[model samples]
Target chain A: MSSDAELIGRSLRGDTSAFVEVIRRHETAIGNYLARRVGRQAAEDVLGDVWVAAYESRATYDRSYPEARPWLYGVALNRLRRHWRSEPAEQPAPDLTRLAHDWDPWPAVDARVDVQAPLRRALARLKPEEREVLGLVAWEDLTVAEAGRVLDIPAGTARRLLHQARKALREAPEVAALLQVPTT
Target chain B: MDEMDLMKKLSDVPSPSPEAYDRARAVLETAVAEPVDTVVRPKRWFSWPRAGVAAVGAAAVAATVVMGVTGGSAPTGTSTEAASPVVESPLVKLASEVKAAAAQPGDSSLVIATKTAPDNSRHVYYTLYTDKGQIFTGDSTTLASSVTRNDDQATPYNAKVMAAAREAANGDVEKARIAMITAANNALGVGLDPAAADKAWADTQAEVAETFRKLGKEVPAPRPRPTGKELENRINNHLWSNATYALVVGAANTEVRAGVLKLLATIKEVTVGETDLDGQRVLTITASPDILGGNASAVLTLNADNGLPIRDEVFPAKDSPQPSKHAVVSYESSRVSLADVAAGKI
Candidate 1:
């Protein structure tokens, strides 16, 4: 199979089928990324625009990069920013905990304690840029350097942001308590 | 929680549903089917000053609308022989309207169109055309206040359409129709192959089938090779569809609008009627059913006063999926000067 870069090259040459293949490869991850930032409903709405935008700008894709995920994330982030700016002011914040419904960290005996709530709050409290870098590295499984490319920032900047986010979470009272607990 | 656990939780979201993926793919397919020029350029963040200038220019043009600098030729009824109750062909009536509208002078034309998708989401576009070959466009999210150039091409598609319309504006309707057809074919990248027309069509069918297989779509059964008048009709229909598309998307030029109306009139099955669109008397042109196969019908509504198109709608066959789903695009147009647009004076 051709790499994403190769497929993008084909797309620039007018082969849209190749671009469709690229979308198929990354839609799941990109969709999840959008859902994490906005809610799932909004993510679905923006997904198509992102794909179309990416296809249009495929000519600008850096062929040196073997994978197109980071570039696609960059496009998705831009779309998300526009969506955020255009959203009505009265809209409520997205509930990040929606993703954790399938897995409960606390068992029956400890169910009374909601361990995930503080983590969600801390995640929300981080600076927007910091959260983005950290999420790309952690949730998206991209390297710090890769996240930097997505944000169009220096790798050192991305690394520092990730470090600051981690340090803040470590110091949070709720997160500290959870870390101190024993784990199997 | 530890970083690993935190990461795992963050990544635990459910994947997009299959329906979502399908809808997104369909959007992509529609976008790709059109000319590649529709690709959107990524916006630069530090362009506020430029945007401000454009906004000022647009405001100037809006203010000038009251001055009547954006005037155009009014639609005139076609000449009729004395005591003849013979009804004019729909094409002839529409052609006459286009000619009358083309007679009115304007420096530029503005067009606003909205496209509604199967999901019911609407994408609105605003376009402006200057006689000197500059095109400006915006959308509902970003109105005409911050219009951008249509493209880097010196002679954009709109200008080309306008030039062709002007060429055909001469009184000879038959000659004008031929010119419009040639222009539409050129725009659509459809070439004439007199010597090997039959073989060329056969090869085209094979290529289409191959493309379908590559895209994982079912290969559709190929019809018998057309010959003589059937082949001629097929070719003309293909060109007609292309011309109609160009007209819908880029008919801001008065002459181009006139040319399109004339070209559409040439199609025997296209019927013209009078109706009210938004309280304004308008001429409606409805394409014959099955003109483009699948029993689809395309209807174009034009402003009866100046022969400008107000809407273009396509209704798919009933048996097809989502029979109620129709593609509708509504248009709004004006005339302005290129110099004013460039100087931030509107």
Candidate 2:
């Protein structure tokens, strides 16, 4: 399969199908990225926008990175920040914990009793940067360096932020209890 | 549970519907279908299609370094210039002459823009267009990058004007006129009557607002369409710019060139002046201040014999929004076969 950079290079020429291929490869990952930040409902709405923004700026994408998932995560995060700031007070934005419980693809995970509230509270307590790096690494399955790239921060900073977040999660009374609770 | 396990358990957001992805893809394709050809616009950036910003007085010096200037033209008056023998109109006579002349010898149109400013840096553009409307553009003077349309050199502007040019070539001046202007600004193709104009204005405002909305930015209030003389001036301004682009881009094609001349002949606001440069005669086509909304005016210089566009300029008036940003862009066109272009031979 052609790399995302190769697809983008094809797009800069007149062939738009190459770009559609790039989107096909990453849309689900990007859709989930938005879903995790905004609720699933809002994420679906914003998914198209993230794709458009990514498509418009694809010319500037660095070809060195073999994977576009990290770059796409960065684009998704920027759109997410804008979505957060622009969302109105009365409008709907379900919490990730609620969204997770509402619909889980995995039968075992869906059947498992929800212990997300304590972790959510603990995650909320961390600094925004720490939470961002932690979520990217733990939730998005990115390496520390990849998370740093997504956040536009250094690998060292992302590692430190991840460490701080993990330590805080360990110390939080609510999260510590959830960790002690047996997983079926 | 470990931190990774704990986070994984929390992040099971439902997948978006396939329809959602399809909607986004359509928006991108809409943008792609238009002239995203080298134009990098941010979400909120609303570039007025009619408003032209290019070179004027100082651009002559730059033109001299590149194309070699002889006698210069201020291009102030529209009424007095002989592009050819005394006929009903100078432009009409020139158009007839060009139409009669053989099309430039090339399977494709080779349009070059060699720009030099005060910085002493040199940049050249070679844009080659097939009669079929495929475009190959690159910065190499040798046309080194003008390979296949699937190559990185392929772009999307000449195709927009190709059909319009073909129409003009076929002698449907009115249809070509509409096509040229509308291609420049899609909204203008609609009627500018009170009801039609209002609807077009509303559509434009909505599109601009949607762009901002998509970027998650505050939507700006739409400006009301201008009334009375203000609307006429704006219309003329766009008409002039539209005609100018069609004329310049399609200069290599005999029918497109003659068709643009016929289209320009209809616009009362557009005036022609003939002048000599380096003993070679050329025509200075001017759109005066009255035609433009503000004091700003624009001029396009053309080769008198064959009607090839040489230099185009915008002299921004006192009330112009961007005086410092004005530029002087010149053109030099030649003929080359597609076979040679594909081979990277100039």
User: Model 2 over residues B316-346: C-alpha lDDT tens digits?
Assistant: 6676554322446678877678888777667
- Candidate 1 chain B, run of 10 with poorest lDDT: B73-82
* TM-scores for candidates 1 onward, in order: 0.55, 0.51
- What is the DockQ score of candidate 2, to 2 decimals? 0.21
Q: Output DockQ, candidate 1.
A: 0.20
Regions of candidate 2 where Cα sits further than 4 Å from its true position = A1-184, B1-88, B117-120, B149-160, B192-197, B289-295, B319-326
The per-residue C-alpha lDDT of model 1 at residue A123 equals 67
All DockQ scores: 0.20, 0.21
Candidate 2: C-alpha RMSD after superposition: 15.8
